[model samples]
Target: MNHLKFLLAIWKANLQSVMEYRVSFLTQVVGMMLNNFIYFAIWIVFFDRFKDVRGWGINDMYVTFGVLASAFGLVSLLFGNAFTLGDIINNGRLDYYLSLPRPVLLHAVSSRMISSGMGDFTYGFLSYAVSGPFTWDGLLRFVLAILLAAVVFAAFLILVNSLAFWMGIVSSFANLMLNAMITFGIYPITLFDNYAKLILFTVIPAALMGAVPAEYIRSASWQILAQLLLGAAILLGLAVTVFRSGLKRYESGSAIQVEV
Candidate 1:
């Protein structure tokens, strides 16, 4: 509970920091949404030319894109530091977090806010909205799906970023992993064979972040939701364990500074 409060406080601080530049923040958000929309236009062209790929249609892309973008947005917004953690670890900046009274991982990952994430988050709903045939229940289900997807994706980010602890500098690999998740995530799951599907569900876990959650959003299958829950728990547990283990070997930069 106390940790939750501390997390909230960090979020509040970051929000306030961005609030000081509301115009710029709004621009960043809107710009990202436009970027996302334009990027999806390529799929628009593909689907227009081909109609459908496998069992997935244009609407399926919309829904999947919505969940995947929102999941990415949540991480980018609330846990923005996840994207930069590799650099932090490599640069010895983690000393600041290590010296803090809060849980180091939580503190390290939640301390920044990427304003563009708000754009992604808002655009996700817009994408879902246009997908049509809406309901209160479906909206609620969408929320649940994105939350679970975000958990799985964030865990993956932390796990990859934590590699910096041993690799010295690995932000490129971390970015590649994240890009793979996004790249593989936006496509239809049926396009892959069983072996490739297994890799998506485990190695990259893009299926958990995209395919599974998107499936749940489109179908509301209890079975799919169960998969989401189990995957989230497992990935989160693994990421936390790996991060803690990495902490044991952390070599502080020892650049002393005071914190109030």
Candidate 2:
């Protein structure tokens, strides 16, 4: 309970700091919305010509985008530092976190919030409102899907960023991996073949990012939901294990400075 309160306090501080610069905050939010809009527009154009690709229609696309956007937004808003973990590790910023009396990984990931994530959250709800059925079950399913997707996304980020301990300065590579996951997640998994699908579910987990959740929502199948839950659990476990193992290899750069 104390840790929860501490996390809330940190989030409140971050929100207040961002709110101090209202224009910059609004610009970042709107800019991300517009950036996401471009991708939706492309999908719209594609669907106009080819009705459905492997049974994935506009509605599937909506669910996919909704899940992915909300998941990404939640992760960024709550754990923005995860996205920059590689840079933080490489730059010796972990020293401050290590000195703090808290779970280092949790503190590090929750210390920052991304202002632009607001737009993604908004976009996700809007997409779901348009594409999903207006029912209690539907809403519950959407929420579940978003939760699972967020876990998968965060796990992937941590798993990739932990490489910094071994490789050092892997910011570019980590970012590329994250971008690739997002890029592949927005599309239909059916578009990929057998081996590609295997990799998507296991190594990258692009399927969990959007595909599996979208399918589960569309079909409401217990099997699909089970797969999503299992996948999320496995990925999360792997991420935590990898990060803790890597922590043993971390060598403090002794970059601490006293502020007089």
Candidate 3:
């Protein structure tokens, strides 16, 4: 109940802040949607030339990408502002958060919404609806996959943000990592070579975000379900550990007053 109240307060504050700039929020949301639409368009073009790539068809890849992007979008919508945690640390702006009676990381990360992420969410949901092999079981599996994907994706970002403790400024590095995940990690893992596949499946586990989850739904295997759960747990654990450890080194900066 306490945690729920805290979360509600954070969400309310975010809504108030967002309402102050409604035009920018709406513009960003539409722009984000358009950006993802282009990627879907690219896929259509690719599959036009070749009916199937690998063992999967266009529809199969669409479902995969849609699930992955949707999962990512949900995380971005709620905690996308977590990216700025690093900046707060660097500028000593964390003093205020530290003085508050709550978990600093939670408050800092959930402070704002990503208006653009709504776009990603829309594309993902539409793709899932349109690319129907939909059954009750498939829908259940898809829900589970999205939940796990959000956990894994958020852990990945938290791990990246924790690097701020050492690097002091890592916006560029963080952006690069996000790009790598989208460019290489977002696609099917089976497309890579044996060694690359091993890396994607085990080391980074990017493939599991979509490829493995899609396979589990198609085959309905307990083994895949177990692995996905384990992967999500491991990532969440590691990210938390790193973040907590990193916070020990955080030094608060002077808060400069600004004229509004």
Candidate 4:
């Protein structure tokens, strides 16, 4: 109950901050939409050159990307400040969070909102809606997969941000991880060879977060379902462990300095 209230407070505060700069908020959303549209266009061009890649047609790829992209947009919107965790740690802003009664990780991240991500969310959802011959079962699977993927993705990002406790400058690494997940992880893992498949499905686990869940929606295989649940469990467990471990290393700071 207390956690729910804290989340509500964070939502209100974030909404107020976005409302303060209405023009900038809208512009940012527009810019993000254009950026995402360009990327999808490039993928379309690539498919035009090649008929199909690994038995997955261009349209199938579109649905997969759309689902994952929508889930990613949602994750970023609610947890946008996660990327700034490194900066917050470096500058001692984490001190304020540590002092708060609620979970510092949740409070620190939930306080900010990303209006730009709404554009991405809209684009992905529209793509998914348009490029579909989906049945009721397929739709249900897709929705469930997306929800589970969002949880795993959030856990992964939190795990990544926790790196700030040890390495003060982690922006480059975080950006690299995000890119790799989008580029290599978003595509169908079955297209890759055995070695590459192993890396994606295990080491990075982008396949589990995006591709595997997508496959389950498309084919409803029991194997795929099991993998999705297993991946979510592992990712969530790792995230919690990493976060708790990092918290112990945190040191609080105050702006008021004593002059020697």
Structural similarity to truth (TM-score) of each candidate: 0.97, 0.95, 0.90, 0.89
RMSD of each: 1.4, 1.8, 2.4, 3.4
- Report the error of model 4 at residue 50, Å: 1.0
Candidate 3, residue 198: lDDT: 81
lDDT for model 4, please.
0.76
Better of 1 and 4 by lDDT: 1
Lowest-lDDT window of 10 residues in candidate 4?
251-260
- Where does candidate 1 stray beyond 4 Å? 256-260
Question: Taking the candidates one at a time, how many backbone clashes does each contain?
Answer: 0, 0, 1, 0
| Tens digit per residue, CA lDDT, model 1, 79-124 | 9999988988887888888776778999989989999999999889
C-alpha local distance difference test of each model = 0.91, 0.89, 0.76, 0.76
TM-score of 4: 0.89
Write one digit per residue (lDDT tens) for candidate 4, span 1-260.
99888888777778788869989988987888788878778778888998778787767776777777777777777777776777676677777777668898788777677888677677766666656785778777877887777777777777787798898778888888877777876576657998998888665778877777777877789887887888888888997788779888877557642211
Pick by lDDT: which candidate is best? Answer: 1
Model 4: residues with Cα > 4 Å off, grouped in runs: 134-136, 256-260
Decreasing TM-score order of the candidates = 1, 2, 3, 4
Segments of candidate 2 deviating more than 4 angstroms: 257-260
Residue-level lDDT of model 2, residues 181-225, one tens digit each, is: 999999888799999999999888899999999888888899999
Candidate 3: lDDT of 189?
63
Q: Candidate 2's error at 163, in angstroms?
A: 0.4
Error of 4 at 247 (Å): 1.1
In candidate 1, position 103 carries an lDDT of: 89
